[model samples]
Target: MPNDTILVVDDSPTEQRVVVSALQAKGYRVITAADGDEAIEKAGREQPRLIVLDVVMPKKNGYQVCRQLKSAPETQHIKVLMLTTKNQDADKFWGMKQGADAYLTKPFASDELITNVTRLY
Candidate 1:
């Protein structure tokens, strides 16, 4: 397996598992967070090269987490891909406005996610 660690953040257990499975299949070392709070905490502690962040979650949302992460020197260099069910253009704009490096809508194909992640990583 590759040594590149990726942090997967999502509130849904099923969704999280799917993301983890896809990333792991491609040989990435994966860590998971169930909510935004844990996402931020683990991102700082693990210092993963990339974070797959969900827009909707308990505690802080993806935008908030992304904003904070991008603003802080410790985590600002880390890249973030916002993965969510919100497919609206405005949502994508908002995510980008909050410092997300990329955005992907849910029901995403494994290859699609991998493509975006690898590009950002």
Candidate 2:
């Protein structure tokens, strides 16, 4: 089995498109959520193997979503990668605190993204 399903949670349509396209091209089954709450719901339903999440979004934010997923037994095993423009150390620190497996700053290289995701798998 390919086992490449990835849930991408980001509010920006442009960012979503870029990330989703890159992952899909790498043979990932991409599912998108526009915000944190939707991410939670979809995560429950889709149970994707990985999640690429954005930090800033309406209604809950990626950190909160990652925390919920990591805290819950039903979702804790799923890997989470934080992909956001917030490059501050505090931001990355907080993302990790919320159980993100990896953090990638925005404007990231496509190859790097692929490498990181592949490594997680």
Candidate 3:
């Protein structure tokens, strides 16, 4: 079944709330993780349809978390979107290499985030 749940991961409380609010306003069932470790745990447990992950974070980081999630059979089916402040070409390439379904930098417009999330589904 298609899950409407979205996991938003970010270390910054302000950023997390902003993303969560935007997603919630669109009627997505939103959950949160303060860091990569929690994100992994929540993903496996919650099985959200999509994860909006931030690349720079305490421990694990987004790339590491995405790679692990993609490799793990239990959570591999979930789509990952790398949301980060790093906008460099190399950063994006690395995110894709880590098995991210899509990559979007921080300071993004709400519609842009929604568009990518919708595309993933």
Scanning candidate 3 in windows of ten residues, the lowest lDDT window is 1-10
Ranking by lDDT: 1, 3, 2
lDDT of 2 by residue, 1-112 (tens): 1245899999999999999999989888898999999999988888888999999999999999999999998889899999999999999999999999999999999999
Q: Which whole-number lDDT from 0 to 100 does residue 48 have in model 2?
A: 88
Model 3 lDDT tens row, 1-121:
3277899999999999999998899888999999999999999999999999998999889999999999999899999999999999999999999999999998899999999998996
TM for candidate 1 is 0.96
Model 3 TM-score? Answer: 0.96
lDDT of each: 0.93, 0.92, 0.93
- Residue ranges of candidate 1 with Cα displaced over 4 Å: 1-3
Models ranked on TM-score: 3, 1, 2
Where does candidate 1 have its weakest 10-residue lDDT segment? 1-10
- The residue pairs found clashing in candidate 2 are none
